[model samples]
Target: MSTICLYGSASGGIDRRHVELAATVGRLIGERGHDLVYGGGGTSVMGAAEAAARAAGARTTGVMPRALMEVELPPEGLGELVVTDDMRERKAEMDARADAFIVLPGGLGTLEELFEIWVARTIGLHTKPLAVLDLDGHYAGLRTWLEDLVARGFARPLAFEVVHWGADPATALDHLESAPRERISLPSSEILGSFADFPDDRRERP
Candidate 1:
């Protein structure tokens, strides 16, 4: 079974709808005969997803940073828990274990994870598929912003093309499973060309 890495909020302040959404994603993962890996938090969206996945018979693995043990304890009955020295290692562990990724509505930390994975995909670090559950237009703004970035040449169009956007869990998972892994070709000349036009100023900003 493929292991799906989930990224979402760990804060207790998120709306109930988001919690339910996370649970749905989890349930679908298990029902489809897949496994789960996520941040080892027992509260908020992270907890909800893990709980539902475990209940549905999916093997759940919680990868957490040791520093967050006190703040975000893992829930009881997790199939496995992998502790790391820091957040970077935690993310790396999760990335290594999962075959695909899905994102739920979240705050700063979630966005950081999403962007990092997307950047990694662009640079050929991994060819795994990723998606954002955009139920009820929650991620519509972010989608538009990303498109704008692509339009302005700040982001690669292919990078955006690889991300599957879905409004439901089952459909998103299906798309991710079927998503093709394409070889990325980004030469240094194309990437560094923008820097060539910049004025070299050795002065420090006030």
Candidate 2:
């Protein structure tokens, strides 16, 4: 019954193995009766995942920045579409809607989403579970780097342990479902400033 947010590549004409992996994840989400929210791109991993999820009877939502409308096309018949004023807003919307997060194989944009959410969780911004789908050793180097950070004392071991890594979709989902939500002792106002103090979503012009 949880709403899972998926982060992955939106580019077209990529490797077929990655595309199948995305589809498999989507199918499992549907079969497990979990809903889905994603970046709302209609190509490659993004599109394949949503399409498979919808086909398997999962309710799917797509969140996108209005600015990217010209650059990315959301799949047709997406259950719902939410347009945000900026990338930050889009991510915020997804964060609020999702109970868990799963990252598929992707490129730079995917990595950006992963680190932002991972850091936010480390700081107690949210306690939801997060995982990365490490298909065919795709994320082996990144995993090594994260471990190195912990070993070097650049990152806390607790923070590093929260990120569950799985080579397959089912194992990833299992970890997410079983992971406990962390309780933060920090005050809400201290962790998150007042809404009034938040900057406007629109970009400033010189």
Candidate 3:
């Protein structure tokens, strides 16, 4: 069985629909007999998903940063929990463990994780399939911006081709299942040239 890593919010203030969506996705993952890997938190969207997946009989693993333990307490009953010294280590551990990735409604942190994985895929670092569940058009704006970047010559066609999107969990899972297990081969120049240019002073602003 594949181990699906889910990136999503850990905030209790998010919309109820998003919470329900997370739970449903988790349940579906379990029902499909796949394992789950996610941020280890006992509250909000991540917590809800973990809970549902475990209840449905899926093996659940959580990767968390040591520093966030107090704030994002590790949930009870995880089959495995890996705590890292920092966020980077936490992300690395999750990446090494997952066979595929799913993006759910979340905040900036989730977006960061998704982008990092997308870049890794573009560079042929891994062949795992990545998908975004665009529930209620949550990712519509981001998709438009990506396409616009390609149109403006800031990104290559491969950049957009690296990602897949679905309107619901089952569709997302199906896409992942059908994806090839071999890494995509791209010329080194294309990979190196895909990065968008940024002003040197951009980081100077706050």
**Could you give candidate 1's per-residue lDDT for residues 1-206 as a string of tens digits?**
79999999999888899999999999989988999999999889999999999999999999988889989889999999999999889889999998999999888999999999989898888889999998788889988998899899888788778888888888899987898877677799877766666666623333
Q: Which lDDT value does model 1 have at 173?
A: 92
Model 2, C-alpha of 67: deviation from truth (Å): 1.9
After superposition, the stretches of candidate 3 with alpha carbons farther than 4 Å from their true spots are: 188-206
lDDT of each: 0.90, 0.89, 0.88
- Flag regions of model 1 displaced more than 4 Å: 187-189, 194-206
User: Residues 1-206, candidate 3, lDDT per residue (tens digit)?
Assistant: 88999999998788898888889989988999998999988778898889999998899999999898888888878999999999999999999999999999888999999999998998789999998988899889998998899899877788767678877788888888888767878787665663446465764567
Better-scoring candidate (lDDT), 1 or 2: 1
Candidate 1 CA-lDDT value: 0.90
Measured by lDDT, the strongest candidate is 1
Per-candidate TM equals 0.90, 0.87, 0.90
Provide the lDDT at 86 for model 2. 97
**Model 2 residue pairs with clashes:** none
- Tens digits of per-residue lDDT for model 2, 1-206: 89999999999877899999999999999999999999999899999999999999999999999998777798889999999999999999998999999999999989999999998888878899999988888889988998899898677677767788877789899988889997545557644545556567633433
Candidate 3, residue 147: Cα displacement in angstroms equals 0.9
